[model samples]
Target: MSGKKCKHCGSSEIEVDPARGDAVCTNCGSVLEDNIIVSEVEFQENAHGGSSAIGQFVSAESKGGASGFGRAYVGIGQESREVTLRKAREGITALCQQLRLNQQCIDIACNFFKMALSRHLTIGRPANLTQAACVYMTCRTEGTAHLLIDISDALQICCYQLGRIYFKLSRKLCINIPPTGKCFFLYHKVANERAAT
Candidate 1:
């Protein structure tokens, strides 16, 4: 019942509902204000015989606790590891699709990328390079007909750069890629001979 007058009926009589956190005008039956802050402080008893505030200010978009809110915002700083992994997965998927690779190949490529992330091999490296390397590794391990040059062409990057990442990733992961077959060598030799002619 403060001296605040209601704009609807100019009535000075207003009742504040603490439970609903609102103020209403009694004379005109109009809601004056809502979401009013109440001075009541709530607390909970802890196992240590201490009292603490009842609830915390949880952000609706934060996925920190068990409340299952949502993903937290990165907010004007370096991206988090999860964000980087997500981007890498997307990039790897796109590159695999561009190569017309099958689902199994895509899945294996994603797994390779995940393993690299788990081992922290992707740190301080371009995400696309890591993605391309993972895809190339998948192609090799899955025995797909794709070459490193195909991935490099799809990503529009230098083959040497992709090759460096590919070799580094293979060595770090201890993956033993199969050597080129005799037919592949003969084909390459014939192609080179034709070009020389």
Candidate 2:
């Protein structure tokens, strides 16, 4: 391939015929080599690493999936599990700041996160929605007080769907938390006083 010329016509157009083991000159139809052996390299690694021929390098999703927080642990490596937990904690802190919640409310919500995740509450749901539900649920448990509609508005979610997810998460966690303030006086009565206190 590197400027191989035929001596008969001094032509640089030479083609390799592997089956016949001959290098034929495309220009003058002359045989340059009667026999040739093809050489290949040895050793291969990093299958599916998604890199170039020289080396292998794999990347990860920054926010979701197995790489970071907002990912439901369907089963992943220890590194990703730690990352997910850290991300969830950061998300809870951010949501608390948005809702103007106190540290007590944040702690209460953070406590329920593991239980909810362990119960597969976020299996088919967005992790942010589940995190928002935790914050809303904590507000309901503590005296902070926010209606489902208020939470939906803050979370930019539909009230009905948020309420359903909240209920399902509560039931799965086997919690009997009582609602406080204006929310309690409206629809559902306080379920458990001890759980709330």
Candidate 3:
């Protein structure tokens, strides 16, 4: 819409992806999916605005009221009390090690990638359901042991839709998200349900 160029490869072919809520570069094929899941924090504000305590509080409170306030307060208040980038980078270092990613360059890369994904994935979106789907896919691809129900319920969407969205988003992001270690957990739950029938 803004006729912007690609940030990754500098291509001039850019458009907004409704599914991911990101501005994508079709030419060089940059996914640019950072902004999709940002509402999860509920208290994060960019330099340009649109996310703030007052705005997020109204939306979050509407979702679950006090519980939402508690969550937002925890997120934002925790951010305010921290040393900021120093601690964040340390955590990122640990995450990189766990994922076998390059600790040296992965922090900023991961931040940029996640931020882009959060922005793009949630465009014209209502809930953090897409974010949950993305996290499930991330866990699956990363082989983490987190369960799908844990992911789906946390995101407030059904498992089937989560799976569909995950694959669809993966295709859009040009990323491969293998079923996570918890994939077996989901399969087992399904098996149990079928057995009851």
Task: Name the candidate that leads on lDDT.
Answer: 1
By summed lDDT, the worst window of 10 consecutive residues in model 2 runs over 50-59
lDDT of 2 by residue, 9-117 (tens): 9888889754344688999887887444344322334578643222111125333222222222333234554555667788888878877888888888887887786
lDDT of 2 at 87: 76
Q: In lDDT terms, how accurate is model 3?
A: 0.51
User: What's the distance in Å from true for residue 186, model 3?
Assistant: 8.2
**lDDT by residue for model 3 over 1-197, one digit each (tens)?**
47667778888778764324356788877776433323443244569975754322223323333333233333544432233333444544544454444443444434433653444653454334454554545555655555656666554468887676656666777676563445677776887689699
Residue lDDT tens for model 1, 80-180: 55567778778887887898888888888888888888798987888899999999998888776667776888889999999999999999998889876
lDDT of 1: 0.76
Candidate 2 Cα lDDT to native = 0.67
Which model scores highest in TM-score? 1
RMSD of 2: 15.3
Better of 2 and 3 by TM-score: 2
Model 2 pairs whose backbones collide: none
Please give the TM-score that candidate 2 achieves against the real structure: 0.52
- State the displacement of the C-alpha of residue 57, model 1, in Å, after optimal TM-score superposition: 14
